[model samples]
Target: MFCGIVAGEVRAFRVTDEPDGVAFLDTRPVFKGHVLVVPRAHLVTLADLPPESITGYFGLVRRLAVAVESGLGAGGTFVAMNNRVSQSVPHLHTHVVPRTKGDGLRGFFWPRTRYADDPDATSYAERIRSALAADPA
Candidate 1:
């Protein structure tokens, strides 16, 4: 889906198309002016992104953050990315959501669920710590 959009094979409201990346409107937007920025190359996650491309990739994100607010007359913008966990697309895409005062959009789509107790929280944290320890990268 993202590949088609980036290649112009799919229809999407285009924003900016540069060597760094491409920007376009999200089909299902949080707000009217929600846009998505994606790399031209097929990169699945931030860890897959080359170190040399980091600055360029985020530069485009920074530009869109400003443009969303100025162009849409929004109070602010919510820039987010989901890696493997909540990623809707296998291809990497950054969501640039326009924000305004009292828009009634609550933070985090999921319900506010808490751990059973501190022990449960500690166990979850340990799992992440062990994963990071094993990963040399």
Candidate 2:
């Protein structure tokens, strides 16, 4: 689905394009200037990507993070990716989101408002911790 974006055949609000990957403004973004860096070749997950391709692909992601932060005057950037679990597209892409202090983002992809208070938050954390402790792997 996203290979078209890398080939320039798919029109998007482009940020930068390099041999390694393509960086473009996400059509559905959490904020303005949000960019998705996609590898030129179609790789379903990060594990599917060749090890040598890592630096080059991620280099563009790093640069776009800076651009999203400085160009948009954001306090910082949130860089992330979803593997097979939550991968929206079958292609690998990195998300670089512009962030401000009170943007209301909390856990990885969870909205801050999804939780209530400290007790509510503690309950969630405890469950995860218990699961981690029980895991044999």
Taking the tens digit of each residue's C-alpha lDDT, what string does model 2 give over 1-93? 588877767766566567888776666667655667889888889998899999888776776766666565679989999998878788888
Q: By TM-score, who's the top model here?
A: 1
TM-score of each: 0.78, 0.76
Give each model's clash number. Answer: 0, 0
**lDDT, each prediction:** 0.74, 0.69
Per-residue CA lDDT of model 1 for 1-137, tens digit only, reads: 98898999997667767788987766666766667899999999989989999999898888777767766567998899999998989989898877889887787772223445545444433432333234313
Q: Which portions of model 2 miss their true places by more than 4 Å?
A: 109-137
User: For candidate 2, what is the lDDT?
Assistant: 0.69
